[model samples]
Target: MRRSLIALSLAIVASTSLTAAARADIKSPVVIATEGAYAPWNLTDSAGKIVGFEPELIDYICKRAKLECTIVAQDWDGMIPGLIAGKSDVIMDAISITPEREQIIAFSNPYARTKAGFLTARDGKFAKADGTGSTLVTTPTLNNAADTLKSLRAKLSGASIGIQTGTVYAEFIEKNFGDIATIREYRTNDERNLDLENGRLDLAFEDTVVLMPTVEKANGALEFTGPAFGGTLFDAGSGFGFRKGDDELKAAFNAGIAAALADGTIKALGEKWLKADVSP
Candidate 1:
């Protein structure tokens, strides 16, 4: 009876040790969410796998940060809510790091910088607008921003403009041009692109990185017009977004992004995918 009791006690100790060991091995992997419809940033391939510039950059970031990560596709409108609800551990959808967004969620250091511009039909009325191909930086705080927006509004007045919902571009349009121009919001950039292609939209505002490739593929059907706006609404550029309290994850990503930027990994990826060096 004594021997049996001793044996049972030993067995229980061993089982407890095994349980602890198993718990130690159970490390959580970071799950990244992105909108697969934003080409050059991210997009679903023919095989239904998410691929693009952001994916490649995130792979490098995860490797540098020693994180096991899985990238998943989510709609643009759901990205922030999904992160807040714990549905995703991170967001790598080229989300601009804007002040308005900062009030809701935290952001890592910017990974890339690009300007926003308008895309219009090649022979459209606004194709030769005064600001075509010019780079303009404006922010709500700038003293001259009101005048600039007034001029821009006049250029786009009475026109139909399409923008992706839940983006800074949408906000910019609503604030500056909504009163004069007809604003159409779509769920995805692809949808907006289709409407623009179908002649349903007079102009479309989007990242120049995204716009350039699309214009190239359009084969003269489309051309970039108006000033390329940066700063302010566009944020300090694009960054990885996390829940407001996830400081540890935010720090890890920021470090990894710094490393990637220092090593030129992001620049190479940006040039390869965006055809420009958009690394911040």
Candidate 2:
């Protein structure tokens, strides 16, 4: 009986140690990856720190979720591959939730929503095209606006368009205007904007909230053309990306997002940074 009691106590201690180690593992800090180049979403500040709407939002989300997290800058092209390889755990770079992306990775419930539009030189011919001044939903298909699409095609036909690669805006432009226009993909928005500014490209397409700053700064040199587009195709909103198997991480972020939205934290931050209520 004495030997058996000693063995039982040893077993209990071993089990307790194992449980403590597991808890410690759970406490490890989550690593979040962002493009750090997209302004008003995520950008690398002059101090070499990543700062912007998404960063601030994530800070609140992490705290609410009781998640210890570290935000890191990453190239836009490598976000998914890095997440898959375990170099990062979460992606918060304004990734639009799309059916195509859903097949490869999981997305937390959307936190913010915005529309896409086209920008061109103020004096460019494309600038003369008419805009609907209202959003057109393009989820599932563009059938709702067949005539509008046709008109836009005729207006923008043969124009050289620039867009950041790996973005939903790029996919939209390619699918809608690929046949009618010359589409050029850049690794970053600044690169594409530079080409457009230098007359190397006729137009650029991107998130309207993102392009608005460029237009305002252009001081009459650039302007938005055509109506902004929404719906799942263009504005399903932005969400945090994770490996499909990381359900725990996704759940934590979903909860955090929900809490933030409920308390108006998201709306307040959106107004401060984007000048609009982007909360979904």
Q: Which candidate is the best by TM-score?
A: 2
lDDT of each: 0.75, 0.77
Give stretches of model 2 more than 4 Å off.
1-27
On a 0 to 100 scale, what is the lDDT of residue 266 in model 1? 87
TM-score of decoy 2? 0.88
The Cα error of candidate 2 at residue 76, in Å, is 0.7
For 1-280, candidate 1 gives per-residue lDDT tens digits of: 0000111111111001101111122245677777777888887787777778988887776666666677776667777777777777787788888777888889999989888888999998868666777887776565646666667777778999898877877887787788898999877778888888889889998888887767887899998877788766557888998888787788877888888889998889988888888877
Cα lDDT of model 2 overall? 0.77
lDDT of 1 at 53: 92
Q: Which 10-residue window in model 2 sums to the lowest lDDT?
A: 1-10
Q: Compared with the true structure, what per-residue lDDT tens digits does model 2 show for residues 12-109? A: 11001111112233445677777777888877777677778998888887766666677776677777777777777888788888777888889999
